[model samples]
Target: MSRYLFALGQLVARRRWWVLAVWIVLLVGAICFAAGTGGKTNDNFTVPGTESQDAVSLLQQRMPTFSGAQMQVVFATPGLAKVTDQQVRAEIEQTMAGLQGLPQVAQVVDPFQAQAVSPDQRVALGTVQFSVSAGEVDADTLDGVDRIAGPAREAGLEVQFSGAVYPGFTADIPHTPEILGIVAAFVILLITFGAVVAAGLPIVTALVGVGIGLTGILGVAAFVDVPSAATSLALMLGLSCGIDYALFILSRHRHNIVLGMPAAESIPLAVGTAGSSVVFAAVTVIIALCGLTVAGIPFLTVMGLTAAGAVLVAMLVALTLLPALLGFAGDTVAKFISPPLHPGKAEEVARIAAYEPERTCGHAWGRFVTRFRIPLLVLGIAILAVVAIPATRMDLGLPSGATQAESSTARKAYDLVSRSFGPGFNGPLLVVTDLSHATGADAAQTLMGRLRQESNVAAVQPGGSGNGMLLIQVFPKTGPNDSATTDLVNRLRDDRDRIESGTGATYLVGGTTAANIDTSNRLAAALPVFLAVVVGLALLLLTIAFRTVLVPLSSIVGFMLSVFAALGAQVAVFQWGWGASLFHVAKAQTLSFLPIITLAIIFGLSSDYQIFVVSRIKEEHTRTADAIASVQNGVAHSARVVTAAALIMFGVFVAFTAVDNPIVKPLAFTLAVGVLFDAFIVRLTLVPAVMALIGNRMWYHPRWFARYIPDLDIEGAELERRFAHDAEVEVPQGITGVS
Candidate 1:
């Protein structure tokens, strides 16, 4: 592995311009191809083989008019008893006619014709049907509807649109968050390196890598059904990982140069050493992300693949592009853009001191922790447990319109409809029945009566029938995200035998709400499997790399603790409504996919830090044959790099919270918190303390098994072996061997 990395680095460094030019060409071509394709991304969460999906399929097949892309244009005339005035009625009718005339409109149901006007007469809903599915509707059709609603708005009436596709139409890729994240990362790097040129290298490398990855993702969308949120997720992961990967290699190169190695020797040495860890870390992340396929969710599968591709690209760029750039810059790269503080010039001098591989904050802190290992370990565990308590009450569901920004047209429409009609109006359930074997009309009538009589049922209306199936719309009294609605769905499905007794009819309760419930349930069932697979794979990889049992076990356990703590924080803010307003959350419900997705990403990222830190400790142990000194020195050596990397990632993740999209915001917050907890509490505190207490046992492994497992040497022990003999020959004048 070291040889290969060394060869690759030397090749890129020698052909730096050619390498850089090739990347530029690929990036440009990718951008052009993506723009030309201009493919659409959808957030459809249909779970194949689920009852809700089956119902949707049946409806689309048999009752096409009722099943196609549907949106509601809500109208409210405040201060008027009802919208019954002749002029208002004429205007609404004309608007309906105009909507129906659009080429995309399959049909438009007028409020007057459908008798959908509220009993109070202050509000009315006009349903528009599009020829394609909600996700398939083009922007032009949505724009046409918006234009048709203009006259009503101008006539002193409130008009708003709300539907599955309505939010998508208004959603914008949040550029503000990405920009702020990059800026924050730059500031962090500047502080860490104390030089503009040194700081900019990581940021520049990361942006280039993420740019290519995101563009490639767009091309992938042209052929596959990628979720709209996938790009944002890719960006978040790509930027952080790209910067961190480059930072690791760049830092190592600088340290080597400070030790008197020339640019030619230092570049390959840095690449061969830190680059191996980057590869290992990247592979772990890719494995954990790709494991999403076991969940059997199409969106998750595609999302995972997209994110993995981005991480892979970032790793490649860090290994190739960063080295080439370093080579091109040569000795000038070591010079700080900002001059270092004068010697003995107060605390600032301590902060801006030149790189010293022998001494680090970690070394001092490791010794302190070792002296009070038990107390520190206990304290760390207690803190994590306290923070993780909120996870116990997590309630997962898709964000409904109520959670949308109040200023959004969709939210305004939802509020108006809920106030005038009912919360149930926002998400009506479609109960479809195959009545071929029963007295069709009578069975339908019986089912409708039964549904209307149920306590939770707000309204039961005939939803048209075709062929051998009967469709009935059942509106629950509660909103879609309400627990009562989920209960109603479960009750209807579970009690089908009692409800349809002697009717010989099959009933399926489905809608946007039911689909959400199904998706949540399916993911919940798959969670255990997903966790087991991810953990098993990570344990195997760690065991092979470290040649130890307790080390891998400890790493996995620490990862879980960090994940739980992060989740608890998320649930407290988003679900419990604590600090919800701070994050712009209008309502408190955990996004259904948040926990699972965060867990996968956090696990992978946490493993990266774990491997880098532990690999260093193991290397020190092997070289010195002193467990205690090795643990302390190793941590001291790796602490600064790990903390800086963590801060960079934390900033990127936090910036994503600025995005208005509910789905992206909570995910970002959780990931940010997870990184912080893992870095400071788990890796920096708990890990070293626990390893100190365990001493040599931390590296214990069965001799037979150790022989079978290949040494990963992620810290580049092999590279050091090849280069140690050349150190004296390569050392510049005035630089002597250590001590």
Candidate 2:
């Protein structure tokens, strides 16, 4: 496999010019098409395949008019006084009238009307009910809200509209991930490679890979419901790593060329070494992403499959298209681009950096590592341990649609209603009485009475006269995370038999909390599957790379620990209120998909760093019998590259946390922190420490396994044989190159 990769690298280098042209054209065309043709979907709650979703579906059938719409508007004066202005009333009436006339709107209540406002009159609230549509009513709702908001806000009144339209905010999120990711990738590359063209390689390669992935996803969404917005984040992340991985190898190859090696010899040498590492990294990522399949949320399942597909595509692009571009661009990429960035000695610097240093006093960096390896390791481990402590407090919950748009009109109105009425107004429980046995009001009343007695229940309204169901309002004593929410759910299920015994009907409980409970249950059931797939795949890759069982097994253990630490930090920030006030955010009802999504992302990215580091160490071990020397050489070589790359990747990932929406914020933030830990702690310190302990035993393969497996040229002697005798061995001087 390594020989074939090297040969492919050589072949591409020979015909680099044409391949580069083709890649550029294909990428440009794909980007243009994706801008218009690529479709989008939401990434929120999924049907749990539980009784809750079933109940919701059944209720929808019985009550076809049930539109998942809730709207709220608050009228607050500077002094919290009532608005008695006739103009305000007139404008409010006009907005309500406009909203009522919207195509799917079932009803719109005016706050000035008798039942809509509270008795005290300090606050006014309105509700807009919708008729269930065949598809999401986002477009119509957003349009109507915009029209209403325009005139409503123009009236010198503060009005907010939130509801179904809130999902549209996510619609634009997917479009700019690649763009944001590209900008981030470039800035990081500049810092790492210290050359503009060198930095451009990763950005360009990522653009090409992501463009193709986008087109592929657009093709797939036609057949399934791919409404998860996190797909954008996943794709961008995949592209960035994919292209950057190639950049790592290609940059190394260019260094060989500057050393006066022939293009044919240099390309293969680069591939025989770094290409093997890239493959290992790619496989680990694919395995980790596949882990999401165990999650079972259709949203998460699709994310798993699609994200894996994207990573696979990126790998192929990196191996083929990227090398071709690098080969064609040749010394010019590093040469012309490196000049202005570094004075006049760019080539000299590249040469000197490429020449593997033996042992040196070096500088402050070396002094610190040599003098304080133990203390630095201890300090790093302690910080990770502290962060991991928060995982004990982590609580997973699906984010409700109401929270999607914090500033949406409907959410604002809902908040107003909740503040003035009760917490139950923000989230209501749906009670479904089995119509087969009891079709009368008496059974409904009995169910309602039972629900009201539960601790979380603030009020139990017998399904209003229209829906012929029971509607219960649950007001948590403290907040959404209050034990009352969970207790209410348990109480309803616990009383199921008694509620139905005499009445001949069972009640199904469905609400935000109920849905959340179902989602949590589904994830728990699927977690084993996710872990099995991820670990199994990662082990397979490790076995293939090191030809040993222990190599992959150890890697998996370390990967899991790093991921747990990342999740723990997320719990502290989102669930524990560490950074909530920074952005005017509230403590989440529970940890959102951030942790799960972070798990998948961190798994893939961390695996990328691990592969690079381990592959380098393995390469060194094959060349020299001294295991300690191999460890020192590999760490010295790959640590800077991994750290610099991680810092750049961290910048991109961290930007997501700054988004206004709460869902992606934590997911992105956790991604940044997780990747940072993976690169610095796991890849650099923990991996080296463990490998040092294992020594040459880390590379031991059972004799029988070796006989069955075909040999690959990635074994160090092959690379040395190919490039060691090449006459172009003049090492350059000046700035150190990426190799």
Considering every candidate listed, which one attains the maximal lDDT?
1
Please list the C-alpha lDDT of all candidates, in the order they appear. 0.83, 0.65
Off by over 4 Å in 1: 167-170, 339-359, 725-739
**lDDT of prediction 2:** 0.65
> Tens digits of per-residue lDDT for model 2 on 532-562?
6667777776676667787677677777878
**lDDT, model 2, position 254:** 68
Ten contiguous residues minimizing lDDT sum, candidate 2: 358-367
- Model 2: runs farther than 4 Å from truth? 15-18, 21-38, 67-97, 107-116, 133-135, 149-157, 164-171, 174-184, 336-348, 359-378, 400-411, 439-441, 462-481, 579-585, 708-717, 726-739
Candidate 2 TM-score, true structure as reference: 0.88
Candidate 1 local lDDT, 507-555, one digit each (tens): 8988778988998888888888989998899889888778888888889
lDDT of 2 at 671: 77
TM-scores of all candidate predictions against the true structure: 0.95, 0.88
Output the lDDT of residue 274, model 2.
77
